[model samples]
Every structure is written in C-alpha cells, then in structure tokens.
Target: MYGGGYVFCEPDVHGQPDDPERLAEFEARIDRGEKIEPQDWMPYEYRRQLIRLIEQHAHSEIMGALPEGAWITRAPGFKRKLALIAKVQDEVGHAQLLYSAAETLGKSRADMVNDLLSGKSKYSNVFNYPAKTWADVTVIGFLIDAAAIVNQVANSKGSYGPYCRALERICYEESFHLKQGYDAFVALATGTKRQREMLQDAINRWYRPIIHFFGPPDNESVHSKQLMRWKVKMASNDEMRNQFLDAYVPKVLELGLTFPDPELRKDPQTGRWHYGDPDWAEFYRVINGDGPCNAERLSARRLAEENGRWIRQAIMNPQQKFTIPFA
Candidate 1:
C-alpha cells in the first residue's frame, strides 16, 4: 500500500523569481481548478515539490512490494500464493505508472532510482519494519492498504493531471487488494486459537508503524501551507490519520482484535480521535535509514538492479531491433 502522504525531508528551495505576468497567469489557472501540465509555466518550487512527491511515491511502490513479495513462496496455499504474486505485480505496475507521471516533470527513471539507491530519497517507512509472519502480510494488506486509499483518494482530486490520473487508477486496484486482505484477516481471526493469536500478535507489532505511516501530527510536520494552496498536498497528516482511525478502528474491534495504543479513542464531543504520540523519534530514525530492514531492503533493490542491468542495456541499445518469436 502507499505509505503516508508526502513526508520526505523538505529540499532547500532555491526559489527563483517568476515573471510576474506568467506567475499571475499560472496562479490564476490553478485557482480556477485547472490541472497543471508539464509544458505549462509554473513556479520553480512547484515543479521541485511535485518531482519530489511523485518520485518518492514511485519509489515507495517498488520498495513496498519487497516485504509482501517475500511471502509469495511461503503463502499457506496455492490460492494465496497466486494472489500474493498478482498483488505484488500490481505494485510493480504502480511504480511504472508513478515513474512515468514523474517523468513528465523532467526527471528520468534512472535519476530517481539512483536517488533511492543513494539514500537521498525515502520510501514509505512502513517497509522498513519486517513482516515476520503471514499474519503481518494480511495486516499490511488490509489496514495499510486502507490507509493508502484514504491518502490516494484525496490526492486523486489534487492538481497535476498525470499524477492524479494515476492515483485514480491505483485506488481502484487497491480496493481489490483490500478485499483479499480482509478475507485473509477474517479467516485468521476466526480460525484456530493459534491463528487468532498470530493475527493479534501481528496487529500489535504493526499498529505503531501504521500510526507512523501517516507521518507526524500536523502541528509538528514540516509541510508547508503553500503546498495545500497549490493542491499538491491534499490533506494534513492528522486529518488523514483521524479519518483512517474513524473508519477502521471499529472494524478492527468488531473482529475481536485490539490496538496497541490503549489511549486510542474517538472524542464524542468534537468527533475526533485521541491517541498518544506514535514516537516521532522512531519515525525520524527509520526515515534516516536506521530501521530494522532498511539496509536489507536497499540491498535487495540494489542487487535486483545489478542483476537486471543487462536487460536495461539491451533495451537501450540503438542497434537492437524488436522481435516476436513463436514458441
């Protein structure tokens, strides 16, 4: 699932002055609710932020696949194995879509990949934690996917036509993934005692990370008001997190499970959820590349890139001609 909304370390804005007439026109266009296209005149910061947001999202999709992809071979049955593989394939497709969308802003896929490899760009921190059991996969697929839907659905309505369009399609496929996850989750919840225990254990381990997934509270986040005005960032981290808890907490409790946060509760008066801080220090540490699986995830990605070098070389070769072969 897509991790939190755009929660990267903010790049230093080397803000350049735009031509006043062009800037006014561009702002007016955005104000009129028009999608920003690549060829359109825009402020440098807008382009920089869009590239950063989209590139991080694209990287997340690929890295997000790693934890779940590792489970395909060990899935409890053939049906689950096939489903996991298909789900993983969908995630890879999402990466391609997001990369293409970001490419419209002038960064190449190679540049983005290099940034990811060099630790200059960050992926969803959720993937930095290990998925220790099959139950963990189910929780990730269900709750994490649900959270992503909330974020993606909001972004789908934002400016930037290509990224919005990509999110629209992504949210559709994620609905199916959620169903698959829910079915698996329910089976475990209602299964033998051991299965139920396993599911609960997974939930306990993942709850903190899930809370962190949405990034820090709005008051603490470095997100800028200008991003919201530009429609680049559709919602605050707190708003999305509250929406997620409102929708999912009841469902989780209904299944006879519990959240790790005892203080988690909805305020009856104001209609907001209250919970303890999800350890922002841990979030920062993980984002800075100190999480349990960060090195492993990056190593795996690097190895895959190395192993696939020949294919990329062949595809880029000028003299190579496309061919169709009969089996």
Candidate 2:
C-alpha cells in the first residue's frame, strides 16, 4: 500500500535562508512546472517538509506490511499464500525506495529509521488498527490501497523530482495490489453466508479508519498554503476523501456492502460527499500511539531493528576485507 496521505504540518519558516536570487529562480522553476532535484536550490522549509513527508511515507510502508504480513502464514491456500507474500514484499521494497528518496533531501536512512523507532516521527494512522481476520486483509488491500492511490497519484504530480518518480513506480505496482484485493473481496462477497458476514464485518470495522486515512478535514488540518504553492501537497485531504468516495462507494454498494456511516451520500449540486464526522478525536488519539496495535507494531519494528544490527555491523566492518568471486 502507499504510505502517507501527504498530511503536512506547518513548516518552520524561520530557518536559514537560501540566496534570495537563487530562491526566486527556484520558485520560478516550480511555477513553470519544473522538477526540483536534490542538489537544486530550495527553501529550507521545503526541504524540511519534504523530508518529514517522505520519511513518514517510508516508515508507513514497512509498518503497513506488518499487519498483513501476519496473515501470510495463515493464508487459506497456496495461491493466496504466494500472492500475499509477493504483495507484502512489494510493500517492503516500496519502503526502501522511499527511504532512498528521502535521503536525497540530506537525512540519512538510518536517521529516519531511528526517528521512527524513537517515536520522534509517525507513519499512517490507518496501520495502527488491527487486521482481525482474513477479510480484513481484503478490506485493507482493496479499500485502503484504493485510498492510498488517490493520494499518491495526486502527489506524483508534485514538484519534487526523485520523490515523484518513486511515487510513479509505486503507484504502478499498487494498482496490481488493488486488483488482487478486489478479487479476494469479490470472492468473499459472493461466497457462503459466513464469508459475506465476515466481509461485512470487516468493512464496518474499517470504514472509519479508511475515512481517517486521508488525515483531518482541510479546514482543521495544520498544513500551510506554502506547501500547496510549492506543489508539495497537490490535493486537500477532503478533496481526496471525496474522490475516493465518488469512485468506490457505488462499487461497494453494488457488492451489497454498507459503510458504517449512515449519512454518506453525494450532494446533487455540489457533487461532493457529505457524511457524518469520522471522529477526529479518535484520529488524534490513534496518531498519538493509543491505537489497538500501536504498541505491538512498534515492538515488532524495534525487535527487527535490534536483531538486524549484527548484519549491518558485519557489512560495514572495515577490518574484514573481501574479494568478489566469479561464478
């Protein structure tokens, strides 16, 4: 699944200044739809904000893999088991690509990883909820991945060069994930009564978090207009959420599934979705490390890091010299 919803906070604008002349050129470049490379002139705020967004995205991909990863061993058949493993592998690979993209902005991958482990940063809040059943995996693969594509496809148009390129590839791979997920979801929806019930339960359970996935409503978000001006944020959270609903709600209804939100509907004149509030209080709480699986997720990540230290040490050891052998 794609990582962040591109939920930005207000960037600190008081940092060191770039040359005023160079900065004007950079802004002009962005205005003219040019991509900003890593070594190119950029405002300090732009770099800081991009680092935060990309780092969170990288962290989200790996952490997002975990909940689904747990289901791999228990996947019902060989076909599913293989597909699930490949999907999870893609998610992890996305993290590597994203971290490398983030590194171009000057933060080391190690620093970002350390920040994630130390709780100095955050990933997507959607992953903090548990995947309680196999049907839940389908929900994540279908609905969650669908929501991510909306956000990512928008961000892919942003001015950042490497990050946008990385997103382009990631979005391509995620389309297949959506197909696999939708196939699984359709199977469950059309199968036995028990299967249908499981799918419904999963949908109900995930509806709120899916709504929360894109971050707060635009009016309440801490994001700055400067980010939008820089093309760092290509779409508002509310806009993306509406786009997801317009695209998916009918499909979901066609499957005989209902969202937990009773008031969900599109306005005739405005063509925008109107729904009850998704409980922003819960969103903030989950983001602050109070969600059902937050501790378990972080513990698993920490343990993995600790266990992998020896391999990193061995790879970096200056005292151990080795020569490549021909096959």
Compare the candidates by lDDT and give the number of the best one: 2
Question: Residues 1-327, candidate 1, lDDT per residue (tens digit)?
Answer: 684656644645556777989888988888999998877778787888888888888999999999999999899998888888999999999998898888888887778899998888988999999999999999988999999889888889888988888898898899889999998999899999999999999999999998988888786434567788888888889899999999999988998889888899999999999998788899989988999999999999999999999998877978765332110
Model 1 residue 301 CA deviation in Å: 0.5
After superposition, candidate 1 runs with Cα above 4 Å error: 8-13, 220-223, 319-327
Per-residue alpha-carbon lDDT of candidate 2 for residues 225-274, written as tens digits (9 for 90 to 100):
77888898888888999999999999899988899888999999999999
In model 2, which runs have C-alpha deviations exceeding 4 angstroms? 220-223, 319-327
Instruction: Give the root-mean-square deviation of each candidate in angstroms.
Output: 4.1, 3.8
